[model samples]
Target: MSFLDKAKDFIDKHDEQVDQALEKVGAEVDKRTGHKYTTHIDKGVDEAQKRTGEGDTRP
Candidate 1:
């Protein structure tokens, strides 16, 4: 499998941890760039995922 595919599989098997890790990553990016767009995009994706009940799929 490609690296991204393996990473996605690893994430699906450990979703909560992966979600938290994603949050932390977005936060760190926000910190480094002094831009909130990434955070906003992340939040929008989360909201869309919740609405669609497609937890692991992209929004």
Candidate 2:
């Protein structure tokens, strides 16, 4: 496979990992700074996941 193919595969495989990481990071930030700062943690994670195509849209 070429570089683009390999890169795409990597992203496909690691997308969930990236989303989970962002959730963890966001939670940490919320805990350290207090979520009272008007920042929606869940929304932030959702947006990040959407932008990265890491979000699973299943109910």
State the TM-score for model 2: 0.61
Which of the numbered candidates is closest to the native, going by highest lDDT? Answer: 2
How many clashes show up per model?
Answer: 0, 0
Query: Between which residue pairs do clashes occur in model 1?
Result: none
lDDT of 2 by residue, 1-59 (tens): 99989876776778877777777888888888777642687778778777664554323
Kindly list the per-residue Cα lDDT of model 1 for residues 1-59, writing each as its tens digit: 99988866776676666555566776677777777587585785476444332264433
Residue 48 miss distance in model 1 (angstroms): 10
How well does each candidate superpose onto the true structure, as a TM-score? 0.51, 0.61
Scored by TM-score, the top model is 2
Model 1 segments more than 4 A misplaced = 1-6, 36-59
Cα-based lDDT at residue 49, candidate 2: 74
